[model samples]
Target: MRRFMKLSRKTLGLLIIVMMLLLSGGPGWARTLTVSQPNQQIYQEANFASTPLGAVPQGAKVNLIRQEGEWYKVDYQGTIGWLHRQAVPEAAPAKMDLSKMLFGGPVKETGSDEVALAGKGFTPEVEAGFRQKNPGLAYAQVDKVETFGVDQAQLQKFVSEGGLNP
Candidate 1:
């Protein structure tokens, strides 16, 4: 009975230690990610519109602090900042022998238009297609509007006058 009690206490103590270690989230738990894309900017905030803190060059390693939406809070070169998720490449999919599958024969890899346009928000081909379908629309006026730009001073003045946050 005494041996059983001693064993139970030892097991309980070990379990508690394991639980504490997991909950503490020490340096061993830190996940380091490499910056895969060039011209990656670390923003003061998670948003792209926010002022950029610094630029993290390609191949630089960053420690991931946390993630928010499409942004990741990272510590790069001891400077904590928010980096876009696009800066890191996702894990590659598992390779499989398609030729050995039930379908038989070697499979040739092909890319569809949908796959090409998957992550592309707006493309020239989409614009051309839209123009073709709606010829009556005044695209020239829209293009002219896009060409308009406001100087920094004027933009700041406008924002101040409108009581908007910079």
Candidate 2:
């Protein structure tokens, strides 16, 4: 009976140690996200109008620190900044490079301009073709509207005047 009791206690102690080892890694673990959008700017603040701290190209990995509304606070290449949620896919799967795994070497890097152009569905060529088809389209008005922007202070004042939550 004494020997059985000793063995049971030892087994229980080992189990507790194993469980602690497993759970110890949980809090420190960070979720890594790959940048899906090219020229994704890491801003100082969550707002787009804020100064850009740096930019991460597509396929770059960022460690998610936390999320605030539509912004994600991330650490990219040791620099901590905020990236818009649009910069990453909703549920991006980890991409494995078989060639890199087999043979250790750097992967071919894609230019930021190329990646940005690829993501744009409506290219200049496409726009020209559309304009040719529809000559009466008001492109000048569209350009004028695109130039209009509200500054942060003005936006806040407007929100407060309307009694809307900022």
C-alpha lDDT of residue 144 in model 2: 100
**Candidate 2 stretches greater than 4 Å from native:** 1-29, 92-166
Evaluate residue 143 in candidate 1 and report its C-alpha lDDT on the 0 to 100 scale.
93
Q: For candidate 1, lDDT tens digit of each residue in 77-124?
A: 889999987888461211234343435877554555343334355556
Q: Give a tens-digit lDDT track for model 2, residues 23-73.
A: 654443357888888868999999999999987999999997766666788
User: For every candidate structure, what is the RMSD over all alpha carbons to the true structure, in angstroms?
Assistant: 10.3, 11.0
State candidate 2's TM-score. 0.41
lDDT of 2 at 124: 68
lDDT of 1: 0.76
Candidate 1 weakest ten by summed lDDT = 91-100
- Displacement of residue 156 (Cα, Å) in model 1 is 8.6
